[model samples]
Target: MVEIISIYNYVMRRILLIQGLIGLSLYDEIGQGYLNEIDLECYITDIIPTLAQVSNHLHPSFERFYVCTVVKKVFFFLDHLHTRRIRIKDIVSSGLLSQLLELRDSAKSRDLVVNETGNWFSMPAVLEVYENYLDLDRDHDGMLSKKELSQYGSGSLSPIFLDRAFEVCRTYNGEMDYKTFLDFYFAMEYRKTLSAMHYIFRILDINQQGYLTAQTLRYFFDGIEEGIKAVKTVK
Candidate 1:
C-alpha cells in the first residue's frame, strides 16, 4: 500500500510538471506573438499563477521551481516581443490566452505563493508594472500628486514621449488624476494608442473603486500584477 501510494504521488507530480511546461509553452507563443499591451499584463498576472501552482504541485522538491520557470519564460517572451515590436492584438487573436486560462482550475490545489519569499514567482511581469507605478508615488499617498509624476527619471523619457504623455494627461479635463496618468503612461510605454489606455485603467482600478488610489492600486497590482510584471522588467 505504501509503495503504491508513493508511485501514485510521483506519477501525479510528473504529470503536473508536464502540464505546466505545456502551458508555459502556449503562453510564450501567445505572449511573444499576440497579446495586446494591456491584455499582456492581464495574462501575466492572472494566468501565470495557475501554471505555477500546477508545476509546483507536480514537482515539490524545487520550492516554487515551477513558478520560477514560468517567470523566466515570460520574461524571455516579453523581451522578444519588445525587441520585435510586435503588436499585442495579433497574439490574442491567435487564441493562446484562452488556452492558458483553461488550465487554471486544474492547478487549483497548489498554492501559487511560495513559502520562501512569500511571493508569486510565476508572474514577474505583473510585479514590474506594480513597482513602476508605486515608484512614481514616492509620498505613498493614496493618490499620485503632480510632483510625483514629474520626477520619473531626470530626462530619461524622451522629449517626444514626455510631451505626448503630458499632452494626453492634460486632456483629462484637469490636472491628470492617477487613473488618467496611468492610462497615458501605459499607452506610451506599450506603444499603443489611446485604445489600449482604457484597458490599463480597468486593470489598475481594482476594488471597482472607479478611481485608483495608490493604496488600492498597489494591493491588487502588487499582490498579483507585480509578480507577473517582474518577470518582464527584471534584467
Candidate 2:
C-alpha cells in the first residue's frame, strides 16, 4: 500500500513538473504583455543580467549543468503551486507549516542581522529546530515516519490524515530503518529552513559591519512586529 502511494506521488510530481515547464516557457511572453502598460523597461538585456546573477548564486558549476536543471525542476514545481494558489501550509500540516515558516523567519532574522549581539543562533539553536520538528511527529515513531504528514492536509490535521500517513509509511517493501526515515524528514524540512535563511541574510546588512549588534537586532524585531500587526489588521 505504501509503495503504491509512493508511486502515486512520484507520478503526480512528474505531471506537476511537465505543467510547470509549460508555464515557465509562457512566463516571458505573458509577463511582457502585462508589463507593457507599465513604464518599466522591458529590455531582455536588463533581465538577463539578473537571471545570470541568480543562476550563478544558485549554481557555481555552470559547466556541470545537471545541477541547474534539477534546480529549475524544483523551481517549476514551486511556481506551479504558487500559480495554483496552493499554500504550502495546505499541502503539509499546520504544525509542519509553522516549523517551516519559523525557520524561514529565523533565516530572515539572521539575514537581517537582527540581534547584532551575535546571539542570533548557534549549534544549540539549530538542534532546537530539529527537536521541535520531531516532537510534532506525535507517534514517537523516531521520525515523522509518515507520508500523509509530509504530503497533505493542514492545521493539526485529522486522525484520518495521520492514518493515511502511517499507512503510506508501512507500505514499503522492506522494514524501514530509522536513519532512512530521519533522512527523508530532515531533507524536506531543512530545505525550507535554508531557503528562508538565505533571503534573511541578504536584507539585514544595514551597517556593512560583518556582524549585527543590539541596536540592529531591536530594529529588525520591531520591524517584524509591525509587519505582523499590519497583516493581522488587514486580515
**Stretch of 10 with least lDDT, candidate 2:** 35-44
Per-residue accuracy of model 2 over 69-143 as CA lDDT, tens digit each = 222222223332224222332323223212212222333443432223222122233333344545556666644
**What local lDDT score does residue 43 receive in model 1, on the 0 to 100 scale?**
41
What's the lDDT for candidate 2?
Answer: 0.36
Local accuracy of candidate 1 as per-residue lDDT tens digits, 27-89 = 455455443334434445445444543443443443233333333333333433234233444
lDDT of 2 at 165: 33
Model 1's alpha-carbon lDDT is 0.45
10 residues in a row with least lDDT, candidate 1: 114-123
Top candidate on lDDT is: 1
Give the runs in model 1 whose Cα sits over 4 Å from its true position: 1-122, 158-167, 170-182, 192-235
Clash count for candidate 2 is: 8
- Error in Å for residue 146 of model 2: 36
